[model samples]
Target: MNPRATPTAPPAPGPDSLTERYVHAVTRRLPEDQRDDVARELRATVADRADSLHDAGATDDEAERAAVTELGDPDRLAADYRGSAQQLIGPALYPAWARMLRILLLVVVPIVVVVVTVVDLLDGADAGSLIGGAVTTALGVGVQLAFWVTLVYALLDRTLSRAEAEQACGGPWSPDDLPPVRTSRGSVGDLAASLAFYALVAGALVWQQLRPPVDGHPLIDPALWSFWIPVLLVALAGEAAYEVWKWRTGWTRRTALLNLVPTTLFALPLAYLAWSERLLDPDAVAAIQQGWPDFDPGVAHLVVLAVCVVVWVWDVVDGFRRAA
Candidate 1:
């Protein structure tokens, strides 16, 4: 008698069926930022568990149970996704910072837009002029936004990457475990360059005061005369102070921040003074040529020079000490 032909077919995967469905459902629901990576990692982890279970002689149904069990709970898994490297600055914090920055930009941007539009409109602006001005203003804002975002994201990436690498090597994840940035020390050449640069600026200010090439009379606002010289003096002093700070600290945050202060102080104060004077008399642009002979730009400036001298001396000593 012919034996009944034995049916040979792959076994139905009951456990895998459930696990696969669960994984797909949960991964599909994962927040967009972490969805891709979470899905990939979870897939591999679950599959590996299935293989191990099969080796242990468990049925497909049982194997799926073990694998899903090993994966932990779905809510926790998604939360991990949020906190994971997949979401640096995290799902939560990133959104908040973005919101705040956007609000700030939007608020300031509208005011800028109105001012620009008014200026353009006053300039007999046609469609082209108005659109162009608006577009240019928007572009400027966009550039600033891009800069801030790029900087923030870069910082997040560096900090997170380092943390992950450390943790992967079995070290504890410490946010403060970040590596310190190396500061640049000014060589003798650098020191000479710094000194020469400030000296030139100082000389230029002197030239402007003694012999400005203005055919029009100078505007004698106590403020205008009071402005540039002291700022120049402060800048000179700031440069020296920065050098000293750098020498002592080898160019750390202190040096960088202190160095940067003069730029804002000098430029911003000058801009504000021009604005104030312009506000004092917008129609009298010619009034700029008047002299503030009674105003002592020189005296205010001498005090500024004294401050700078102090800074310079400190820097010379500090630089030598640090270099030593």
Candidate 2:
């Protein structure tokens, strides 16, 4: 039997009134297990307040409205109930800390991984060794990033006055400053997945160089390593940073336009390389010819070009669509 499906007594009915609406707003933000109890307690408190006001000669409607107003914004009240008001970083610095940590993790971690992987690749390490080294380095870097960022924020929280902290965090928060309900545009999971995908791509680019050589040449042309490959790697890093910024700021028309820079930087050069038949080693091409004898490199180039164009267009379009 499903635990969630287990039978339980229904909640006692409350009046369909202003207090009910206020209670619902507060309790809805609470954990499911706590909601019923919190809702009941909140309703009782509101009733008592309203009763006192009514006894002081206010009408029922006025008393109820005043009681609810006295409780303040339901969202803020919910935060208090959840004990979010207390923290190592405190409320003022917590938001800034979280945002900075997210940016650092998203932007810095992947770059560190890619750089470590590339360095290991250049050092002539085997694929397994390089991959393991990259993973270990990434973990170390991540821990350091988290530790330092937290320490700095904790120091700031301790050192700054409340007014200073509030100013640094973009002033004291208000009901008007409450964020809208979240949408799917800037999901952390999605950003992580994208970074992981780029890391895999970087790994693949490095691994291809270590493949069994055809006439002492890897599958990818070594000549392009001087410029094209390095530029591509830099572009990939830029793309990763862009993903982090997008996740931090969410989609917007300006960001959508900015997205084109890294997308084109990656796609156009790759397409050009593939189209000009410089992407793959000539010996590798010859080996393919020897095996199949009918392999047309032009067809391969066109396929690559088409794929690049399609992916580039789709990414740009999706950004604008999400922003909208």
Candidate 3:
């Protein structure tokens, strides 16, 4: 073809123009290839919106300008569209997993919270104590929400992308993303938290066994003491977080695992606490004895608790490696 055969192109829209400006604003927030895809989607949405306005009596140019104005500044809109909320709800709300989470939280959390609050009140807790407890509860919930919402949605987006690509390429989820099954191991902080948690559970079990019983039967606190579990769990989690910081490493997974180790350890005691409080199971946990000959379940429990502590420490450290 001749060099002068093709007509010259028109100059691009001015910086002042609305549609061009809007597209430019949000596109930069997206992935390179997906940038164009999002831009096109936005464009289509704008065009359709503008067309509807025109049909409702606005002039064509006025409608287009209105759509552009509705989009607002490039930076804010771009940042919001690229945020974690979009990946979580704007994208996943329709997914089965997302719906299940909504149902579980909506139905379960308030009931549990109310019951716990009532139990706390009946235990002769003062107004000042309840107010302080509420504040602490709110803060703990906010932290967990901040962590899980961001991480899970990001993970979900990544997973979906991989799944889509695999469908196109005839592949499966990659092994690299899956952590290897290996022996558990952990850091100093993890060891401390695990040891502390187990030591505490062990201590609690021992204290119960040693406490003098009423009429040869163990005495129980009957006002539904299971409400204390969340407060206790939060305290343990904070300890785990401190341990993660203490064992600072190049291995992020180890830190995360250390974090989870506390959660698991906390759960065991929390479970035992619930059982003791609700079912009033006296024989469930027993004190450790130097000499044991008969079928002593307490011995088995003590062994399990000890094993959990050791594995928890290792788990915390190896969680750093991520191949654990």
Candidate 4:
């Protein structure tokens, strides 16, 4: 008489079981909306396959192993169901990456151009050299931004492979995740006014040089124009940068500290010109004196210099007070 074969033990139950783990592997990568339905279908399919194998004379353990093996790697199965194969930066993250790149290019390129141009000009560079330096700086910054941003996203895509669809987005992102209402240190009107002021000052300075000379003397000393104009542009650029920073980051102790550099850079030159009695074109001053015989030019110059200094001090104090 042939003895009956000993019954083999079925797979373990609970989280440690092969079936639950495999199901979890697949479902974790799926969206919550699809997870329940897909899990049910997957479990049903696996059970049906196992039962068929059991009827074909395979034991429970053997059937379970065969069924899981037939489905192949858990990761591959998840990818297949999601229809997203491995990618450097998947479709899920491509839009974010593109948006970031656009913002960086728009913001960084202009800042870099301003900085490079200022540096070159301060070094007594020719116009050609200043333009070339700006271009080079912008190109370098662009390449660095592209490379690092892409590399980071690629790493995130690969590392977040096992995360749930929503979880892989870095967090549970929802409409509620957005700020309730936007707030800033400065308003749009303030930024616009500041920008307009810079434009007007720059235009006025340039016009003085371009306009016909008054009695063989320009509104500004041409020699001072060659040197001081660049200095003024640099100061203007620094102030513009601070305005942008304030608009974006709002007031902060850090911003207040940063304000010191630009104010000092701006005031020092104007203060020097005022003290040395060379800020205005002598001919222009003489013409003014001719019109007002009682006017004391030295006193007027001292008053203007004092006003500039006071303005700078007031600006620095205001920045810190706002931060507080």
Candidate 5:
């Protein structure tokens, strides 16, 4: 009789099986230099685990599924093997990243869209062009904001130590940092009003130049159109952007300090112009004098300067009060 042939171990699962697919998923994410070794090791480990399960009375298909399931998500496993983080911004920096992104989207994006729309409207663009310009501006600004914000946070996540990252994200949270709860509807209305006021201010600045002149002179000094008027408009735009940020973030000492920048930009220039008697066009002033003989230019200048001082002080005070 022929010698009895010893039964050899069963061959490992085929390439198309669940175990092979799982191995592929994991190795694909790994570096090319590490892929071959990792794939071989992973495949052998999975096959052995599956075989043991099968011996324990699981069917071949059930064993293969169980082996892969026990390994968890392939993306996570790949990250483990590479010794890298699984997130763009880790938990330490995520809150700051999220808050910054919200502020940018809520503030910068709308400002960009509105500016583009207004420019297009002033150019007498057709309705289609106006809508398209606004939409495109919004999308472009949003994409830029997201990419840059993510890249910055990702770099910080990789390069900074944990303590450094926490500090960079404004340090550990405290009860004092918590914002006072306010009605959401009221906040929304306030934001809307602030935005609208800025829009009107911007529109008025441009409209003054476009409107028919009174007595051969614009209401504002024509010389101002060369520099100071544009500066004022830019300052107003900055204020508008800050207003949106403040609305979202609520008040803080830092924000209050920042508020002084745009306020000074606007008020200082006006005050200087008023004090030097260069604010109104001489022709416009003459026309006004003709209508009201008792109008005093000196009194008007003083009144304008006083109003600027009062408004600037009130705004600065209000910001700190809200923060407190």
Candidate 6:
């Protein structure tokens, strides 16, 4: 043997080859329950194909490349493997969904803005605050609208597709099996008004924290700013989410019942704070007391707590009434 001959490199791993990478890409999109089985099947298929190519006298690299090529694009294969197609809303439902969403955003949103602007003007917010608040409400409502509509349609797509698959597999299929039409649609005006009110309250809460008015400290409890503000914001977000859910599904009994969670969260802390005399600044209360000699801070706090309780209880009752 010649001493100067080149040393050969070891062959790359068969299982750790491009075929394995392609299989990994496909399985990762699948659910955890099915991923292992899908991955196993894909690997076996790739291995069998590569072996066939090898039998035809192709080298390992060539056979592997040909096998992978036969499988095609990973994303397309993944879409095929998924129980539900990778889409926001499928073609079958896109038209109705798009039409509904378009109408909601176009007709409902402007009316909301105009109505909010009028209410703010009546409440005496200046030009800057009014415009800012309106814009915030529009943006928040728009985002909520798009998100919820898409989510509902996506759920529908999955459900309808799954039902079709089950029927194909000899599962029961009947119009008579459909759930009762228990859905109750809210008026567009009502939905828009509720959404605007939520946006206004949330914006006012944050605004006070960032920039209190020139004459007075914020109405919110300053002592609780570190913790309560974030909690309040989360509660506000939850309320907004509920409003969107209500808008999408209407005043169903389930939604009526679920409304209590956010309502309770929003009211409880404020009620506690008011009753415990932690809700407002002492300085602000003194200023108010100076103007009104008969003012009693203790009584005022109790009144506020009572009002909050009443409002929330009424809101829950109203939800049930609407559902009925």
Better of 4 and 5 by TM-score: 5
Candidate 1 or 4, higher lDDT?
4
Candidate 3: stretches off by over 4 Å: 1-13, 30-87, 90-127, 146-150, 161-324
lDDT: worst 10-residue window of model 1: 278-287
Give the best candidate by TM-score: 5
- Between which residue pairs do clashes occur in model 4? none
The candidates, ranked best first by lDDT, are: 5, 2, 4, 6, 1, 3
Tens-digit lDDT string for candidate 5 (170-230):
7877787765454332287888898799779888777876783676667778788767876
> Comparing candidate 3 with candidate 5, which one achieves the higher TM-score?
5
Quote the lDDT for 158 in model 5.
Answer: 95
Task: Please report how far candidate 2 places residue 181 from its true position, in Å.
Answer: 7.3
Assess each prediction's global lDDT (C-alpha) against the native: 0.55, 0.81, 0.53, 0.74, 0.81, 0.73
Provide TM-scores for the models.
Answer: 0.28, 0.48, 0.31, 0.48, 0.67, 0.46
Lowest summed lDDT across 10 adjacent residues in model 6 is found at 2-11
User: Which candidate would rank higher by lDDT, 2 or 6?
Assistant: 2
Candidate 6: residue 123 lDDT (0-100): 71
lDDT of 3 by residue, 185-223 (tens): 355665676658744753453344346353333433322
- Which residue pairs in candidate 2 collide? none
Consecutive 10-residue window with the lowest summed lDDT within model 2: 2-11
Per model, state how many residue pairs clash: 8, 0, 7, 0, 0, 0
Looking at model 4, which ten-residue stretch has the lowest summed lDDT?
176-185
For lDDT, candidate 1 versus 5, the one ahead is: 5
Candidate 2 per-residue lDDT over residues 1-324, each given as its tens digit = 523321331233256888899999998989899999998898878877777777778887888899999999998899898865435688778888997898678777876677667767687899899889978988999999999999998889878988999898767766644433456447788899999988788667777786655655677888887778877886788798888787766776767887998899899999999889788888888988887899988888899989999999999999889766
Query: How would you encode candidate 1's per-residue C-alpha lDDT over 189-291 as one tens digit per residue?
Result: 7777776886686566545445533443222332343445455455555554455445544643334444455545554554444444431222123333254
Which residue ranges in model 5 land beyond 4 Å of their true spot?
1-7, 11-43, 54-73, 126-128, 183-200, 212-214, 219-231, 237-251, 261-314
**lDDT by residue for model 6 over 1-324, one digit each (tens)?**
534221332244466779778988898888899899998888867766777777778887898789889999988898888755778677666765786697568545654565566557647799999999899989988888988988987787777765563453335545533323535456678878887887888788767755755247665656676666556555665676678667776665666787898788789887888878787767667767777888887888999899989999999999889776
